[model samples]
Target chain A: MSFKVRQEIATCGGKLLKLSHFSELIGLSMDVNVYLPKQYYSKDYEKVIPTVYYLSGLTCSPDNASEKAFWQFQADKYGFGMVFPDTSPRGDSVPDDPEKSWDFGIAASFYVNATKKPYDKHYMMYDYIHKELPVLLDEHFSESSTKKLDFLDNVGITGHSMGGYGALTGFLKNYDANRYKSCSAFAPIVNPSSVPWGQKAFKGYLSDDENDWDKYDPCKLIKRITNTRNDMILIHQGTKDPFLKDNLKTDLLTEASKNTSWEGKIDIRYADGYDHSYFFVSTFVPDHARFHAKNLGLI
Target chain B: MSFKVRQEIATCGGKLLKLSHFSELIGLSMDVNVYLPKQYYSKDYEKVIPTVYYLSGLTCSPDNASEKAFWQFQADKYGFGMVFPDTSPRGDSVPDDPEKSWDFGIAASFYVNATKKPYDKHYMMYDYIHKELPVLLDEHFSESSTKKLDFLDNVGITGHSMGGYGALTGFLKNYDANRYKSCSAFAPIVNPSSVPWGQKAFKGYLSDDENDWDKYDPCKLIKRITNTRNDMILIHQGTKDPFLKDNLKTDLLTEASKNTSWEGKIDIRYADGYDHSYFFVSTFVPDHARFHAKNLGLI
Candidate 1:
């Protein structure tokens, strides 16, 4: 088995499998936590469980969402599994932020394939997350069994903050191919190319060229990609989020969606008196879970 | 207000208020997190909100349970507030274990009033949790207002591991006074007098004498206290808990209850494949919440 079991913890009605495997894409041993719902162990159950990939925000690892997001209950309730992937590749060999800041390097990959020197060697989060990870998970999990889990085909994607931006970018970039059956975000950095957090990451990972950024910018991707399936993207932004006014201008995505096929389908919700913490992510997780469940044909 | 608001975070249709205040009993400042449910903000609702006091395990602050317990949803659903108290009195002034072990010093108070040496002056968690904290909370929250919350009465007590022992000790010691309307625990140290973790704390905080330890031990308290109201104490023990074979030994509590008035009233449910972490506590929080809600008349 390529994936090593770090720990198998029983939570809610299922087990949380903390797995780590060497990713050829990111060139590091990537950690991921998968919550297999109660149905997986039920003798009477027959359906192959679909999965929801939850990407965490800055300074986060796979354990953060696994511990705090409270998604295991929702996954069990809907009879779906949850996959929590690490924010970025890490090790002593990997290059870090030159200034040692949180927003540019290490735990802040921006889920982009880096093109710059130093970072380009190991910071291949985009390809790791969207390409290698899912297929590998399916092969490792299903190849040995009766296809109890489907990680490649019937999948949904969602994230928080930087991860939200990742979800949007990956979803929009692969909209035509329908890589993600459902997509949503919580307090995501929508217009990363315009924001400082995104600009720093884009400039550090990619070059100063705007062309490199336009390839992954959700705002630009939203305008170019046509919604062939009439699928809607769910979003929840807290009014009291510390980053709302500055980094996460969620309204910018709404504006970018204007006059495009994705316009009016990007459902943006404003949660009053909430912050950009796990408290907010966990609170709205039910809504996002249900939305994904319906889209992934779980409901 | 004598209590300072450290932070007020919105979580799951409620606000988690992090408060810190000087504790005259313990002679140190203590931190606590209180979650005021959604019912508190409703103009249409008039019932005074009862509270559940959740004592955390060793080496945990109020923030651990406040963030990981996933109780705010249950509190909002059951129309009850939640109180997350610090495990022990902190700051450099407070005495720590001579060995600086996590099970006996700093974060680990064993929720008992110490009677020996430097520990006696500060390790007054028993009085701090059951007596002073509750009365002080009521005085601070309801002294001037229309009494929206009841901290002194109509309360439930619950905890995990070391804190579970705290809950049981607090509940049984005050059983005659009818202090808490409900009590429950998640993988609690049932017989602290015998367990190594509990014995270490007892020796450090109390004394070498077994008599002093008997006062705080649940096994002794269960036999001494009579359940006049026939109140049941709910407990969830994990079969796969690493501490089960040694420190916890939850079945001992059941054995101790054999001939006493509390016999069969201590309902212990063993969860399969669970562990000694917050993952286990959070998984069964719903069950404990329901049990407390029913006993506290929230159902």
Candidate 2:
């Protein structure tokens, strides 16, 4: 339940704290980064700061978004804090891809609770990220600081690629419970069950039964969930992304919401000439921040 | 004389064109990245876009600042163009550091023309960056597009660490000729002739004559150059930078300016808890951009 501060980095009008903590769910050490906006350090600030959770893509750590996403400036602008969670559980004993490919294993947990052998031991990332991490963060911040930083409620969720799928799935799965107030993604694999990257991860982590895959698929989850609040899910996809045709079928998610309660509520923007990199993600971050800020009532 | 478009990346509200060209000065193929602001692509923008040349530090290609600096947003906000020049001339024919050290050869040219053997053949970065590159860029852009992108007179210069030293040296040395309109630096080595990193670069690139080193040292140049335009050189130094004490002594430049015409004109801001990495550089980019925009009459 205790976190070790690895490094405190001074960024744009904020401090990025890199922390590592032992997770009981996964039984391993996990790394996360938190960016405290300038408002957090100001003596005159009195209001509680809301949070935005950003999950990273394949082969990425918390450091990737912390360094390149350019989110600190926006967090400071909107008076909100940011949380960057690692992509997957990592350790020497953790099971990795037998082929040692980048799209699966150590850095790619697909944000699912594994029921399969070998992966079941430490790859409980879905539970670790959405469930345990938030409670731990709330307890830690409450014990350490006089300022109130919300980690449970008044939170927004967003991610890139695989994490995008995770965010969509999480937001949809917990829609009735009101888990996240806002959700967005950058070049996300919407229908992962159909994509090669998603299929591989699902097969490796979930089970042989195809029905189990629908539990985490954003396309399928959108059909079952009811959007009572008229909430909008913002998404940005690059037209020049190499994985657009093969892995990220952005149109499928929109197609899935054709007649459901989620119809006309998902905003999928196609950006021209942008690639599936931080260059593209950081560019559209300001828009996403504003979207989340509006939904979180920070604007 | 011609540049090859390696990649044109869409970032922020503009495009980053990665270009490679054959330089007559260095006699080697050089790579440079030009970021055209959104104004260039807009129909209403009629004024020539001012340019800001950013020189990267040791062991860095043009890609480092292009990907990490987060300068594109500022460029779009202020309607200014950005130029990122490579640190050194690289090829198999070009000589490298005898010790294979990062601080001496290859990516550490120190932006000085070499007068020594071997290095003298291709290490002509001083002329290449300040003189030849600008003319070539002007000619290239003039032929390629209708949008007037200024790379010559209406320009500012900035860099980090060794390149920070380069920016200062180039601005000060060419002050009389009015080469650059504004100048700023991030954690630059002020007194390069005295510091270990600078000493190594100067020794490897220049001749044995100690007088040759004085020609490029910013501390020495500041004392000799007269500040007539009431112009201020903006500089940001991190207090927690690992190389602050050993390599980057920010006070030396201030001390050198004492009793000289340039006294009280050097704005060296010491940022607390920041390091020598791009994190520190990107954090203060907005301030520097505004400073240059004001100096270049863009504000």
Candidate 3:
């Protein structure tokens, strides 16, 4: 219903803005971590930099990605701004899950367009994150042709696990597919159709028709359509992930890539002994940002 | 009871062991994060590496230091093993403050010898962390050297907030203080006797006598004793931290060091716009590690 600016910390000349906003979208007061690149405070109003939005996985809020992954160093190096959105709504008339855990209720929104009754109103997370949140970020955080980022600079997308799924599907279905110069993910769940989390959330959110699942499946979408701008996708998967066998099917992605073509290429690196955690992401996020920078012509 | 390792990821040719343990010491199981340096797994059994244990402040678990602080990059670089023990015992057995939200009961144990009952039993966290945990870590992990440390080489201590107090007291009282080559912290609670957190935990766990608090207070102890070692203590504090004036009193440390006739030195840096969060620590840990590494003769 109402949004508040909780805290703002100036980091490396730029500002790290922590905002609390009531989302008609996610139906809770969401905390977003927005980074205005050093250029924003450089006094050069004409200089504009590209932007990158990072979505986090289940059971995690905006702070997890902003604080844990150490992404700012890379953002500083690459001269890009980063936006991190909380995973789900909290502290409203929202219903709590009977099982009190990190997953399922508060944090484990699968980033889907919810259709279920109690969840549908507040659970419009997909729209809020992909549509409304970005709009608000662009308006409040973005420079007014005024400085850091140009009025028309395209924004890139990247995430992990559920976020990776959101990054893929949201970018694909959104109007700004061409705006993102490059996309990447770390240990992302590829085919939700075949995973337990996917099965659970999908059954509750989507109609029972399995045919509709492919519309949201990244592996399936990649297979069905050719790229609009790039030839390949950049992905990093851990070989020893606990959820790899059941949830994240990189094999299916490999299989899908074989059939479908993109604009440039797909660079998939399978790191050994990493897991479905922030440690794995922190280890490779610099490289991922570099990957996007290269595609975006920043490097 | 039962000890189960949730995850163990190899890093820098060693392992970042995340295990949940059944504690006879704490009376309940706790999740701990341990880093066994490469020397632990090396073929040369005669080689000994000094370890630097890190303690975190309030609302932090073992994972905070291990995962969020970005210390491993430097730990590997410096060739020193790192061990992070949980701040307090978890689960229902650990009595929480009925009123307070963040500070007193669960996350904020002052790492002193607990004298209060109920809490005194499970809250002997100081000994559990500094003594018993190290022994358990040695038995389970490959780095099974309890008291054995490389005195001739480099050993150091560093922490944040309450953990900073632990590092200061721990290093000062080591059976061999000369073993520690360096000392540092980020926004540490300098004079625990003066702060609310210190007052609460100390009054609860320790006697009301103010002089007794000096044993654990770095600023107090520094004035009363002389350092045999000829190394400098590095401290990094954020200028904008809300708790800077009252909670973290580095000014007392500055005054004490000025008057103390010690051979050791203190170098404190006040970073601008940073807060008392891992975001602040992660931003500066590399420099801290590098400082230790240079002193450790690894750089």
Listed models, DockQ each = 0.93, 0.82, 0.33
lDDT tens digits, residue span B1-299, model 3: 24477878854346787888877877788877767665566666444566667888898988878877877766766577787777887777677767766877788877786777767777777667656666675565445444333523356678898888778776665524464576778888878888887888788777778877877787777776654456677888988888998888877788777756542377889998888877788788888888877776666
Assess every candidate by TM-score: 0.99, 0.98, 0.84
Q: Name the TM-score of candidate 3.
A: 0.84
Tens-digit lDDT track for model 3 on A238-266? 88788889888866777766745642355
Q: Give the per-residue lDDT digits (tens) of candidate 1, residues B129-244.
A: 99999888998888645638989889999999999989999999999999999999999998988989988888777878878888898999888875568799999999999999
Cα RMSD to the true fold for all candidates: 1.0, 1.4, 4.3
In model 1, state the lDDT of residue B178.
Answer: 93
**Candidates in descending lDDT order:** 2, 1, 3
Cα lDDT of model 2 by residue, A1-299, tens digit: 39899998888888999999999999999999999999999899999999999999999999888888999999999999999999998878998999999999998999999999999999999999889999999999999999999999999999999989889988999998999999999999999889899999999999878889999999999988754787999999999999999999999999999999989999999999899999999999999999999999987
Chain B only, TM-score of each candidate: 0.98, 0.99, 0.85
Tens digit of lDDT per residue, candidate 1, span A1-299? 98999999998999999999999888779899999999887888999899999999999999998999999999999989999999999899999998999887899999999999999999999999999999999989876666489898899999999999999998899989988999999999999889899888998999888888999899999888865688999999999999999899999999998998887999999999999999999999999999999999988
Candidate order by TM-score, highest to lowest? 1, 2, 3
lDDT of each: 0.91, 0.93, 0.73
Best by TM-score: 1
